[model samples]
Target: MATLQQTEHNKTVDAKNFSRRAALGGLLFPAVGLFLGGCTRGLTTAAAPKVAIPEGRGAFALRADGTRAFRNHELVDQNGVKVRFQDDLVEGKVFGATFQYAKCEGICSDMTQQMKKSYQLMKPIMGKPVNFYMFSLAGDSPAEMKAFMQAHGIDNLPSWRFFTGSSEAIADIRWAFGFGDPNEETDKNLAGHTGMVRFCNHKLDKWAACPAQGSPESTARLVVRLFPSNERPQLAGIASKIATPSYPMKNWSPAKPLTANLASQL
Candidate 1:
C-alpha cells in the first residue's frame, strides 16, 4: 500500500541494514579467527619444551694434591716401547690413566669407546702434550694391547699409549693408583674391571677422576678439566660440539670414586 518513492526508501534502508550486518559479520569472524590463532600458537609453543641445560657442578676446581709417585714398575706399551712411570708416563706432564684388559667381554669395550671419543674431543689440544695411558689389569701382552687399541681405532693415535707389565707389577700399579683391590675375581665373560679414568696435572699436582662408563662428552669434560686453564678452552669448545647422552639414572654404583682424593678435597 506504500507509494513508489516510499517503497524505494524502505528497500534502501533494508539494504543499508543488511550491508552493515554483513560487514559486521565479516569483522567478527576475522576477530574470532585471530583469537583462535593466537591461542593455538601459544599452545604449540608451550607444548614444544626447550631442552634444559644440565646443572653445572660449579667452576672447575682442583681438589687436594693426592698424587703418589708412579713406582718404578716396568711396562711395555702398545707400540712395543718400554715405558717407565717417571721417564715416560708422568714426567712433569699432564696425563690420564684408565684400566683395561684384553680378555674381558664387559665394560672394557665401552671404556675404550668412551676413551676414543674423549681423544677425539681432546685432539685439538693434543699438541699441548697431554697424554693418556691405559694400564692393563689382566697383564695383557703388548700384542694383545695393540690388537685392542687397533680394534678401538686408537692404535694410531700418538697421544694415547697402552701399557702392560708382569702380573705383580700390574697389581702394585693397580693398588697404588687406587683401582680397587686387584685380587677380586672378575667374570671373564663380563666387562668386569674398574671403570674409572684418573687424570692428573703433574705441574700443578692436581688430580681428579671420572667414570669411564659415562658418555664420551662427559668423560671428555673430566679430562679437559685436568688440563691447565690455558689449554682447557679449546678442548671444552670441542666437547660442546659433541652431544650429551641422555639415559635413565643408573642403578649401578661406580667401582670406585672418580678421584682418589675427593674426600680430602671435602
Candidate 2:
C-alpha cells in the first residue's frame, strides 16, 4: 500500500507538471493527452489582436526579418495604446515581452520570475521608449492589474506595461505572437498556456524568440558572442524545448542530433 501511495504521489506530481505544460500551450491544443500535437500550445499568429502579454499567453516574437508575420498584427499596451510594428510601439528602445496571468501558481509564475530577472538585467538599456509588455491570459481589469502591480512594487517602472484583453480576443491574438494556439477548445481556460518572450528593435520588421530566463542584455551579449555561431546551434541553445511530435512550432525541428546532450540541457 505504501509503495502504491508513492506511485500515486508521483503520478500526481507528473499530472500537475503536464497540466502546467498544457496550460502554457493550452490555446494550442485543447485536448486531453500527453502526445499528438499536445505541446505547451501550438501558437499561431494569424489575424488576432496580438495576444496581450500580462495575462494572455501567445506569440510575441516576430518572424524572419523579411517574414510576413512581421508585417501584420497590433498590440495594446498598459497606457491603453494600440501598438504595432508600423505604429508608435517605441521606435528606438529595446523592448521585452512575456505572458502571464493575474493568478498564476505554477509555470506561469516561474516564467514571470525569470522574466523579472531578464527585465532587470535589461533595465539600464531600457527606460523612456524602452519598454516591457507582459500580456495576461486572464484579460484582468486595469484597476485590479494596477493594484497588483503596485503591490508587487512594479508601479515605479513607468515604461513597463502589463496588458490584457477580452479572453476571446486574446485567444485569437495568440496566433500573432505564436505563444498559444487559439483554434482548439476545452473546459480548461487560456490560463494554462505560457509563452516565450521576444526582444525586438521595434523599428525592424523581424521578431526573435527569447530564452526562458536571464537578462535580455546578457542574452543579447551572448547572442553577439555567438554571432559567428551557426544559426542552428544558436537556436538550439536558446529556444526552449518541449517533447517534440507532441510540441508545436513552425521554425524549429527537433534537434534529433541532440540525444544525451539535449537531455543534459533539459
Candidate 3:
C-alpha cells in the first residue's frame, strides 16, 4: 500500500511537470513568433539601395529613359537575336511597328502584306535609316516566329525584323503603341484587334499611324513623311500628290496629330 501511494504521487508530479513545460512552450513560441514578426516588419519597411543597371538591363530599366514612355522589355527576333525594345530597336531610327500572332486567322496576314507593300514603296525613295518591326502578340518562341515568317513567304530583311517575347512585355509594347481598343473587352479579345500600323521617329519625336487595312500607298506615304525633309527629298516633292482625308474615310476615323505625350492617354 505504501509503494502504491508513492507511485501515484510520482505520477501526479510528472503530470504537473508536463503541463508546466507545455504551457512554457506555448508562451515561448509566441515570443519567438513576435520576434520574427518584428524582424520581418523591419526588413520590409527598409528602403532598398539603388543599383545602377548598366545599359538598361534590369526589370525597371524601361522607366529610366524619360524621353519615351515605352518599356525597354527584352525581345527575341526571328533570327534568335535578343534586343531591347526602345534602346536597340527604336532609339534614333524611324521605325514602323505592328502587332501580330503566328497562328492568327484574321487580318494579321493582310496587315503584314500591307507592310510589305509599304516597305517596297519606301525603300526605293528613302535616304534615311528605317526599319519595320512585326511584334508577335502570342509570345511565340524564336523558332516559331521564324517558322511563321517562312510560312508567310516573307523573307527576313536586314531592315525588317520579326519578334516574339514574354506576353507581359508584348502587352506593354502593344498598349504603349496605341494598338488596343478603347473598349476594354474588345481589346482583350484578340479577334477584335485593332489593325493599325504605328510609325515613330524617335529622333524627331514624331509618331503617326495609318490603317493597315487601308491603301498601302497611303501607308507608305505616311511613313516616308516621318523622315526629315532633306533626307527624303523625293518623298517631299510628292508629298502634295496625296493627303489624309479632311473627313473620316471608310470604317476608320480621320487622321489626327499624335505626340509622345499622348501615350499616357492610351
Candidate 4:
C-alpha cells in the first residue's frame, strides 16, 4: 500500500512540474512575440517611402484665392518706372515677387540672399522671360531700395527689380498678394509684413508661394516647377539636375506653411 501511495505522489509531482513548465512557456512566447513585433514596426518605419514632389507634369494648380486677391494696382520699379501690377509685372512673363523693406534687419536680408541665389540658378534654363520683383512693405523709395541692394552686395540681375509705391498703393499690393497686415511692425522698426516669395506662371495660371527663408535651391526649384512642361521642353533635362530645397520650419503668419513634400515637388 505504501509503495502504491509513493507511485501516486510521484505522478502528482510530475504533473505539477509539467504545468509549471507550460505556464512559463506561455508567458515567454508572448514576450518573444512582442519583441519581434516591435522590431518589425521599427523596420517598417525606417523603410517608409518618402513623398516625392511631382515634376514633368503640372501637378500643382494656382490658388483661386491668390489670383482673385490680385488687383490691377500701380507701383514703381527699381528703375523708377511707373508700372501697373497686372500689366507690367504679371501680364506676359513668369513672375516671382517678395515683400521686403530696405530697412528690415530681420528675415529680409536672408530673403534677398536666397533670392539672389535663386536668380543665378533660374537664369540659365528659364528659357522664356522671367521676372522677380521685390515690393517694399515699408514704402521704400527707389533710392532707398537701390541703397539697400548695394549694401547687401546684390548685383542688378536682369530678371530682378526692386519696387516701391505710395503707402495706399503699397497697401493695396500687399492685400492683393495676401501677405500679412501691411501695418504690422517688423524687427528693424519697419512696418509689419509677410516674409514669402510668391511665384507664378501667369500665362499658365499656375502660382505658388514659399517662405523667403528657404534655401535658394528650393526657391529656384519652385520657380522652375511653375513653368508648364509643354511650354518649356528644355526644362525637362534641367529640372532633373536641380536639388529640392528643404521645407522651412518657420511659419509666415496668416499664410499656410510650405510642406517638405510640397517643396520637394516644387
Candidate 5:
C-alpha cells in the first residue's frame, strides 16, 4: 500500500510539471510580442521636440512645441556674462543642447562629466565649428559661475556655452527643451529623474533626445558624425591630465572612476 501511494504521488507531480511547461510555452510568444509592442508604443507616443528659437542657426526651424526660438534669450554665460544663445552659431550646422547646474551633487555632475568626456572624444576638431550648448538650470550666480568655470577647468573652453535665467524662465526653457523630469517625486537617486541629450537638426527642423542615464557617449557619437574632424587629443595635452586611458575628447569613458564611485550611493 505504501509503495502504491508513493508511485501515485510521483505520477501526479510529473503531470503537473508537464502541464506547466505546456502553458508557459504557449504564453512565450505572446508575452514577447506584448513587450515589444509596449516598447514601440512608448517610443512613438510623443512627438519629438521642435526648435523654438527662430533667429539663430535654427531661425527657420520650429521647436518640439511648434514654436520658433529666440536668437538669444537672456542667459548668463560661464563667465557670469549675459550672452545670447546664438552669439556663436556657425551657419549651416545643428548642435547639441542640455542643462545642468554647477552645484549639482548627483546626476548633474555625471552629466557634465559625460559631456566633458564627449568633448574630449571630439577634441581633434576643437577649432572647427560645431554647436554644443549647455545651460545651467541653476544659473550659478555671476560669482558662482566664474568660480565654477575655474574649478571645472572650463575657464578657457569655448566649445561649450552655459546659461541661466529666472526660476520661472528656466522652467519654461526646460519645458521647451524637454529637460526637467516630470515624475521627479518618486526618484530616490540622481538617475531617477528624466535626463536626456538633445540634438538639434538645423536642416531638418527636428531633434533627437536620449533618456538612457548611461548613454551620453552614444549620444555624442550620434552628433560626432555631423562634425567629423576625427583627431582625438592626448591626455598629456589636456589642461589637466587624467590617469585612465581616457581618449581626450571622450572625457567620460566607459568607466569614469569618480562617477563609478558615486554610482554606488545612488
Candidate 6:
C-alpha cells in the first residue's frame, strides 16, 4: 500500500511538472517569435537607406502640385546680361512665357502681338508687379532678341524680358516648359512650334496654359486669375461684372486628354 501510494504521488508530480512546462512554453514561444521578427524587420530597414528626393530630378524641388521642372542653364537676357533661367527670372515670380525665333513671320508674330495686348490689359488691374519671358527657339543673341522685340513694339515693356541660350539648352528648356510634341518628327519641325502661352506662379507652383491665338481678353483673364485674389481686385471685380461671350460651335471639338508623359510633367 505505501509503495502504491508513493508511485501514484510520483505520477501526479510528473504530470504537474509537464503541464507547467507546456503552459510556459506556449506563452514564451509566441513572444520569442515576435521579438525575433521585430529584430529582422529592424535590420532590413537599417540596411536600405531612404532617399528624401529622387536622384537627378531635384532641380525643381517639386511639390505634390508642382507643374514641372526648369533648367538653371545660363541664359542671356535682352539687355545682354547673363542670368540663371530659374534663379534670376522665374523663382518666386508670377510670369508668362512664350517661345519664338527672331525671324519667324507667321504664328510667332501673331503670338507676340497677342501677348502685347494681354500685358496691356493685365497692367492696369495688377496690384503687384508681374513679368513676361520670351525664350528664343532659334538661339537668337541678345541683340537679335532686342531687335525682334523692338519690331513688335514691345521692347519698351518694363516687365517683359527676352532670353536666349545654346540650341541644345533651349531644346531642353522647351520640354521643361511642357511645350513639345510626343511625335519626335513633329517636334523637330520648328515652323510648327507650339503657339501656347505658358503661365506660372512659381511661388505657388500654379501653372496654366492658353492658346496664344486665343482672344487677348481670354488670355488676360486666365493669366490674371493666377495672381493672388487680394492682388487682383481691380481685374477680378471687372471680370465679375462682365458676362462670358458666347462662341459659335460650328468647328468646335471636345478637348482631348493630354498625353501621359505631358500630363505627368505638368
Which candidate has the highest TM-score of all? 6
Identify the runs in model 5 with alpha carbons over 4 angstroms from their true place: 1-72, 86-93, 180-193, 211-217, 225-266
Task: Kindly indicate the candidate among 1 and 4 with the higher TM-score.
Answer: 1
The alpha-carbon root-mean-square deviation between model 3 and the true structure, to one decimal in Å, is 24.7
The window of 10 residues in a row where model 4 has the poorest summed lDDT is 32-41
How many clashes (backbone atoms < 3 Å, residues ≥3 apart in a chain or on different chains) does model 6 have? 0
lDDT of 1 at 144: 93
Per-prediction tally of clashes: 4, 33, 0, 3, 20, 0
lDDT of 5 by residue, 64-143 (tens): 43323433445665555554333232122356666666676667656666766666665554434445666565546766
- What are the lDDT figures for the candidates, one per model? 0.57, 0.45, 0.59, 0.55, 0.46, 0.62
lDDT tens digits by residue: candidate 3, 217-250: 7887777666565555364422566666786568
Evaluate model 2: give its TM-score. 0.48
Please identify model 4 stretches exceeding 4 Å from their true place. Answer: 1-70, 125-127, 181-192, 233-266
- The runs of at least 3 residues in candidate 2 whose Cα sits more than 4 Å from the true structure, single-residue gaps closed, are 1-86, 90-93, 186-188, 214-266
lDDT of 5: 0.46
Q: What is the lDDT of residue 33 in candidate 5?
A: 8
TM-score of each: 0.59, 0.48, 0.61, 0.57, 0.50, 0.64
Ranking by TM-score: 6, 3, 1, 4, 5, 2
Whichever of 2 and 6 has more TM-score, that candidate is 6
Model 6 lDDT per residue over 47-120, tens place = 21212332221123343343333556678878787776655665456777888889887799898997888877
Which residue pairs in candidate 1 have backbone atoms (N, alpha carbon, C) closer than 3 angstroms, thus clashing?
106-190, 106-191, 107-191, 209-258
Q: Residue by residue across 46-96, what tens digits does model 2's lDDT show?
A: 343342233223223322332122232354544555555322332333455
How far in Å is the alpha carbon of 134 misplaced in model 3?
1.0
- Model 1 per-residue lDDT at 61: 18
Off by over 4 Å in 3: 1-66, 125-128, 181-184, 233-266
Per-candidate alpha-carbon RMSD to the true structure:
35.2, 17.7, 24.7, 30.6, 22.8, 28.8
* Superposition TM-score, candidate 1 onto the true structure: 0.59
